[model samples]
Target: LLTVIVTAAGLVSSELRSGSAALTLAKPISRAAFVVGKLSAYLLHLLAATVLGTALCVGATAILFGAAPLGDLLQAVALWLVYVLLLTCFIVLLSCTLRSQLGVAALGIATFIALSALSLLQPLAQTPVGMADVVTAAMAGTAFSATWPLVTSAALALVLLATALLVFQRKEI
Candidate 1:
C-alpha cells in the first residue's frame, strides 16, 4: 500500500497534473484500459505485500511462538483475510476518487481511526457503567455487544469498490 502510494499516486499524479494523460493516450490505448492497467498494477503490488506479510506472520508464529493448533490459527487467518480484502477495496476506491498521495493518506488515516473507534465502542460505552458492572452484566447475558459496525463496514467497502469501478471507467483522465 505504501509503495503504491509512493509509486502510483506520486508518479501517476505528477503525469495527470502536468497534462501528460495525452502521452499515455499516444500509446493507442483506450482511456479505460490505461487506467485499469494502472489500477491492476497497484492491485498486484498490494497482493504481493499481503501474501508476503501473511507468510511472514505464520512463519514468525511457528519460529517464535511454536506451532500451535492449526484449526484456530487457520480460522483466525481466514477472518483476517476477509478484513484485509475489505481494506484493499477501500484503498482502491479511495485511490480512484482522490488520485493524490496526500488525499489517500488522509482518507486512510481517517478510515483507520473510524474503524478503530467502532471496534472499541463497547468498552468505551461501558466505562461509565463501571468495570464490575460490565463484567457482571456480560457474564449474565451476552459476552458480545452489537456486531452491526463490522457488518456496516464490510457493506460500505463493497459498495464503495463497486462505485469506484464505475466512476473510474467513465472518468476522462
Candidate 2:
C-alpha cells in the first residue's frame, strides 16, 4: 500500500516541482497523453514488482510448509492487485492536484485509513472499501465472494483516472 502511495504521489507532483512537467509539456504530446504515459509506466513497474514478490512469497511458503495452495494465493494476489490499482489511481489523482509529494502521500494515507475504518460497517462490506476483507478471506482459503468489490473498484479506478486527467489538463504548470 505504501509502495503504491509513494510511487503515485511522486508521479506528477515531483515532476512539477522539479520543473520537468513544464519541459515535458513543451513537447508535442498532449497533457492527457503525458499523464497517461506516466500512469502506464507506473502500472508496468507495479505489475513487475507484484509478480516477483508473489513468486518469492509462494516459493518461501512452499519451502517452509509442506505445500502451498497456489490457487488461494493467486486469488488473493489478484484481489490485492485490483485493490492496489484502485489505490494507485487515487494517489495519482492526488498527485495531479497537489503540488507537494508529501502532502499527496499524507492525504493518501489518511484516505486509506478512513476507508479501512469505514469498511468495518456491514453496509460497506461489499464495497471497494471492504476489499481488504475479501483479500483476507481469499488468503485464508475461506468461502468469500468479491465480485461486487472487484467491479466497483475497477469502475472507481477508471473514474479516478479520467478525473485526474481532467484535473491535470486544467492545472497550470
Candidate 3:
C-alpha cells in the first residue's frame, strides 16, 4: 500500500507539476492512452515486487523457524494483493485530483484506516454487552457472516477506480 501510493499516486501529478506532462502530451499519445499505459506499468511493477518480496519472506521464515505455514502464507499474501490493487486504484484516483503526493498519501492512509475499521464492526458488535448489545451484536454479526471484508474492499476499489478514470479524463492537464 505504501509503495503503491508513494510511487503510483504521483505518476500523473508529478509529471504535470514538473512540466513534463505538456511534453508527453505533445506526442501522439492520447490522454487515455497515457493514463492506461502508466497505470499498467505501475501494476506490473507492483506484481513483480510483491512476488519477490513474498518469496524472500517465505524463504527467510522457513529457514529461521523451520515450520513456515507456506499454504497459509500464500493465502494471506493473495488476500493482501487484493488490498494493494484496491489501494493502488484509490491512490491513482486521488492523484488525479490532488496536486501534492503528501496530500494524496495522507488521504490514502486515512481512507485505508477507515475502510479497515469497517471489519471491526462485526467483532465489536459481538462483544458482550448488557442486553441492548445483544440485538446489535446479532445484527452486526449476521450482516457480515456471509461476506468477506476483502470482497467489500475490492468492490469499493473498482468503484473508486472507475470514478477516477472519469474525473481524470475531464481534468485539465
Candidate 4:
C-alpha cells in the first residue's frame, strides 16, 4: 500500500503541483508507454522488496507457527505480490487523473479497503437459503486451485493497465 501511494503520489503529484508535469507530458513518448515504463520501474523495485519481505515474513512465520510448510509459505508470498501489483495500477491511475498527492493517497487507501473486502466476497456471498441450512458452505475443491489464482490476478492486472493507459492518455496531468 505504501509502495502504491508513495510511487503514484510522488511521481505525478509532485510534477503536477510544481508545474514540471508539462515537460513530461510534452515529451514525444506516448502517454501509455510513459505510464508503462514508470510502472515497470516501480514493479522492479517492488519485486526486490517483496522478495526480502516475503523471506522475512515466512521465516518469522516459521518460527512462530512451528514447522511452517515451506511450499505453502512461498505460495502465500507469491499471491501477495500479485495483490500488491493489482493495487498499484489503481493508485497510479487515480494519481494521474486527480493530480493531487493527498487525493492519490486517499484513493489508494480507499481502494485497498474496497478490494480487501472483495477478496473476502466469495465467502460473504455464500449463505444458506433455508433457515435450517448451515450459514457456511464448503467451496468446491479443484486441482486448478494450484494455478488459477495467479492467472486470474494477472489477467485483471492487464485490464487495469489498459484502463490506466486509456485514462492517463486523456488526463491533463
- Location of the lowest summed lDDT over 10 successive residues in candidate 3: 126-135
Cα lDDT tens digits, model 4, 6-92, are 666655556667877677768787777777887888889888987888789778877888665565546555555666776677676
TM-score of each: 0.58, 0.96, 0.77, 0.71
Candidates sorted by TM-score, best first: 2, 3, 4, 1
Residue 91 error for model 1, in Å?
A: 2.7
Best by lDDT, which number?
2
- Whole-model lDDT, model 2: 0.91
Runs of candidate 4 with Cα error greater than 4 angstroms are: 56-68, 123-149
- Please, what are the lDDT tens digits per residue for candidate 3 over residues 32-53? 7776677779888878988999
Winning model by TM-score: 2
Candidate 3: give the clashing pairs: none
Question: Candidate 3 at residue 24, lDDT?
Answer: 89
User: For residue 45, what is the lDDT in candidate 1?
Assistant: 70
Give the better candidate number (1 or 4) by lDDT: 4
